[model samples]
Target: MTESADDAVLALPDRTLLILDDDRPFLTRLARAMERRGFEVTEADTVAAGLVAVDKTPPAFAVVDMRLEDGNGIEVIRRLKEKRPEARAIILTGYGNIATAVTAVKLGAVDYLAKPADADEVFAALMAESDDKAVPPENPMSADRVRWEHIQRVYELCDRNVSETARRLNMHRRTLQRILAKRAPR
Candidate 1:
């Protein structure tokens, strides 16, 4: 039994899929959904477990969290690609950044997606058939909004220290304070 949202089946010779994430609930839900969608799902919560799975049986597809509690998912991607050169992998992360995305792709990840992405989006990323770039997001974030989001993320990573965050972002402390005090842009 499965939800209709995941009823659409994926036809492929090797439907084996490896999904690694520390979020237990998300991992369980995604594992179930992928199973219903015709994948032989193997779920792991840590990088070590992911590596074991990759070594024992390289999956045809993988969805790895960019930053696991134990280690970065790039190591898993690297091992999976070494074990199975044609494996398709995607990095899922809450802290999405250009540097890590580029690293993931360079290590043979098929795509990089932000956290909270739905099953359909993950499926689409894994199964893309061509070299075409991603289509524009239907509701692209405004540039102001993107800047705000980046600033907020950096701020949090800086432990909410305004001076450190401002210094790292190369913005005046007063300007950052003003932005932080306002509501996020739509």
Candidate 2:
């Protein structure tokens, strides 16, 4: 089902939202956050469960983590869109990459955001594009399409040490410090 920009703008009533993620802690945190916003939320730890949940009871919106233990989030998004074409979707990914981002958008995701994303950021991404509009070009990282694939590798190699991570990336410790400060809330 194809939806246009105008179709996205249709006001989303207060309704149940679905979130798909394999990490139990993250899923719990996300559900609580969305609940705080007056949205009833349901969570699934696997793509198959998420699909089944939507089939049983369609949600108003969905936030799907790109990587799942059993399957990828893009598959969940596809099934959700198929089951409930009107449900708005936002892709959440820790394994951010250009291919995944493009695939999510092509599969009908409203926006793609990196993991550790704050609840506000997640909600904004889904709502902001209710008009199905493309993200603004001026937005950094929004259009860059280059996922921080190197950052994780460096972080792992550095044993999650900010100083070492900075050194390996050939960037100032303070710069890496600033980026670390903005990691999504767990």
List model 1 lDDT by residue over 1-186, tens digit each: 763423443536788999999999999999988887889999999999999999999999999998888999999999999999999999998767666888999999989988778787888888776595896666666788778878877897799999999999999999999999998776
Q: Which residue pairs show collisions in model 1?
A: none
Q: After superposition, how far is residue 181 of candidate 2 from its true place, in Å?
A: 25
Against the true structure, candidate 2 has what lDDT?
Answer: 0.77
Q: lDDT per model, in order?
A: 0.88, 0.77
- TM-scores, all models, native as reference: 0.77, 0.66
TM-score: model 2 vs. ground truth: 0.66
User: Per-candidate RMSD vs. true structure?
Assistant: 4.9, 8.2
Q: Report how far residue 13 has shifted in candidate 1, in Å.
A: 2.0
- Could you give candidate 2's per-residue lDDT for residues 1-186 as a string of tens digits? 986433443434646789999889988998998877667799898989998988898887899998888878888888888888877899987777666778898988888887768787876676674565654533345322342555655675578898888887889999877766665322
TM-score of 1: 0.77
